[model samples]
Target: METPVRSARRESAPLRSTLVAIGLTIFGLLGAAIATLPAVLVDPMLAKGVAAASIEGQTLYMILNFVGMALAGAIYLAATGRGWSYVDFRLPSTTGWIYVLVGMGASIAFLFVVNIVVQLLSLPAAESEVVAIVGQDQTMILIMIGIVVFFNAPAEEFLFRNVVQKRLYEAFTRMQSVLLASTIFALVHFPMYVALADSIAATLTSLAIMFGGAIIFGTLYVKTRNLVVPIAAHAALNAFQFGVLYLAIEYNVEGVGTSPSAIVGILPSLPP
Candidate 1:
């Protein structure tokens, strides 16, 4: 007989548990709907193109979809006698941090390669919608950090890896479960791209990137059996991307005819 951990790592989830997870994901969808209520009720209609691109709107959307649903899922799972830790979800440890660092490194490489492929394919490479919403505002940047790091990252890992992948593994092999869950994860992001992409091909290409990211995060979860590993990795990647964007937009480090102050910012300030 397999030990609990061994079975967890290998077994197919029960039908009832799987159903519950699917339902919880639905509730997460509802949260997304509610998040956009403000835009929905207004004359402008916040479905995607307009409200979805505002900093305030995006924050609400992320909070509802990530944080709101995350809490509900936790409660529901606990009621069903499967607390997060029961699913191998817990805070990171010293070793866990190491895995997160490694995961981040691998994720960066993965995204870099994916971006290259996307550009080569003549597909949209930037999530410009996100950048447009964030703009050059410092406050918006900080809020984005919170959303990406504290809410969106962990929330996604919790849902796709801890819940979806875990339950899927109950019936499928580990690899199959990861692949399936990653595909679903990628698909969920489809709507986000649809409004912003210039063409369907661009949206599809963005989905491909999401698919790749999902696979990377899912693999980390399976290998370590720790949610924090993937969460930190996801958060770290978001942080790095946003941080780079900040430096680029704020300082314009590489723009033509760069200003003296901008150049000075890059160089040593030297003692007064």
Candidate 2:
């Protein structure tokens, strides 16, 4: 009787683990969505000029979004009994730095491929929700560069990589976990691009690019076992991208598609 009972528990373990993983994944996704609500709510005021569409307003918006996500992630951790111990935030060693550099380079290289593929497919460029705000107030670009590194990058990686991807590892293979997490990352951004994209095809392509970029970030986190690697890499990429947009706008460069809308789809993890 004891042997039969033990075998029955063993048979149910995998199923139980899988269900738990699925439940947690849904919770993480919902948390991310809810986290964006405050920022989304402010958009109406910005448009009406009740809050000026300036750098200050945009910065507040970003801060709200970042803070919301961070709080949600903290709650998720606490609920799971993992808390902060589950995440690896120690400073990267020399080898970890090498991986950081590799991640940045690989992400950039990946962008180049994405740009070419977009052109080859003749798909129209996809714009993000942020691009609309930038179009209204150019000063928003200034704020973007300031916060993207310190806020946007860390917020996304901490939630998606550290919380979501790490949680998935318990029930899935390394590759499967990465892919699933990346897919969720991409899906969460879909609403931002849907109306802004030139066509459904363009929107889908943009999400695909986002998914791929997330995969790169996820892989870096998995390989290094350090969240900082992905966070740093994500920060550097956003900084480089927004920097280029600022330069192009300042120099009045044209016909090169350097605007926020043109390049936003090339990378993932931009502000929501």
Candidate 3:
């Protein structure tokens, strides 16, 4: 039988872990907000010097956004006394390969459905302030896609699937954790669309679309019990988004009377 003191300590361990997890989650959220400040607040200063259509500026904005969130994830791991295990990034088993296909296929289907929905409903089809304000030269679009697929997507997976959902799983059902994390994920991204939101309904529509995608990604993570599954799938989603955008630019797939930004806004979807 355990001693009284020993039994007390055993029970206390979970409480300690819960406390630490909660604190770290809050820190991660604040850190993410801080990280966005550069692009959200400071980038306007730099944009003035560069040409309105400079690809370099848009790339820089994305890089800064990703680095901030990724950095927050790293900080959360360090503060919580967790390591790669927090991220669960180990080489998955042979069977785990199936999940990769699962994520990509689901993402493709979601995008197709989303694209159809956008067309069916004549919604506000104007690009967000971020895209309209910065610039995207055709030469750098592929580069943008490469960064998004490799860095941006993985960084988000680490932050959301690995850190946020992983911690929440200990306190909630798998589905609960997925929906909660996905909701936060969607909300955090609102800054990207906030300026372009003409009304509450339009904003809600964008948020709902993103939340749905996050659910798919989160579900994939839960299914495989591996971060790589969601990461790969997220990258595939981003790849498709970029490919669509590039194709639009190349083919000038704009509705009559619509600006390039308007076409991008109305079609498939823009990166969020």
Candidate 4:
């Protein structure tokens, strides 16, 4: 009788977890869509009168999106009676810092190597595009960097790595959670302007690279159960990318640019 009862409870656990995950996913998506509604509706209307309206609109959209996600997370956690202490913000441990540094170094090295290969291959250069985007207003670029590195990175990590990843991990295995969360992260970036014929294909490729990166970050978070490690790592990575762009412009460096696909070339071949 005891053994049968325990088996029944164990079998039902996964089903309950899956239901929770599905609910969270739906809430998150809905919240995100609602958050962007102002930008979708109001930004264009005020575009002509206010030169800075576009930037303001983008900022508002980001703020709302983060707030919405946070609210949704709060609701889910409250409903489940999961302890609120799950939002661990402790700084990464010494070993975590080591991982962060190593990860950052590897990412920068990959970018450099890929740029060289891309130049040699004569692929399209991103320098011109970068310049066109950032050259017009130096102040705007600085502000944008501040927003992205400081505000955006932390918010994104909180949403994807902290909240979504944790919830997904509870429902699925480590590998499944990592892949799914990374895929969602990459999918969110697909609307950005790009020349790729199939945005979905490009997104999947980006997600794969991001998935690898996310795994490293995810592992650090799981080991320490701290948000700080992933947050620092996330911010550092964003800063590095910004630094690369700033240097590329400042030094007038030009080369055929590497897309995320170049990660394949940059990473060392694994043993068969």
| Candidate 4 residue-wise lDDT at 213 | 62
lDDT of each: 0.63, 0.70, 0.64, 0.55
- lDDT per residue for candidate 1 within 186-234, as digits (tens), equals 6665665665566787677766777777788888888888988998898
lDDT score of residue 121 within candidate 4 = 61
How do these models rank on lDDT, best leading? Answer: 2, 3, 1, 4
Error of 3 at 200 (Å): 1.0
Off by over 4 Å in 2: 1-44, 47-52, 136-138, 255-272
Question: For residues 1-272, could you state the per-residue lDDT of candidate 2 as single tens digits?
Answer: 57988899877765665555455545554554466556556565544531344455556666655656656777878987998898789999999999999999998888778777766766665665555556534466666776777777787788788887887777677788898888878776676677567778768887887888899999999999999999999888877776666677777777333332344532132233
Model 4 clash pairs are: none
| Model 3: colliding residue pairs | none
Worst 10 residues of 2 by lDDT: 260-269
Candidate 1 ranges with C-alpha deviation above 4 Å: 1-23, 35-61, 253-272
Q: List TM-score per model, in order.
A: 0.74, 0.82, 0.75, 0.68
Provide C-alpha RMSD values for all models, in order.
9.7, 4.1, 6.0, 7.3
Ranking by TM-score: 2, 3, 1, 4
- Name the regions of candidate 4 deviating beyond 4 angstroms: 1-26, 36-42, 45-53, 109-137, 171-176, 187-201, 255-272
Model 1 residue 111 lDDT score: 59
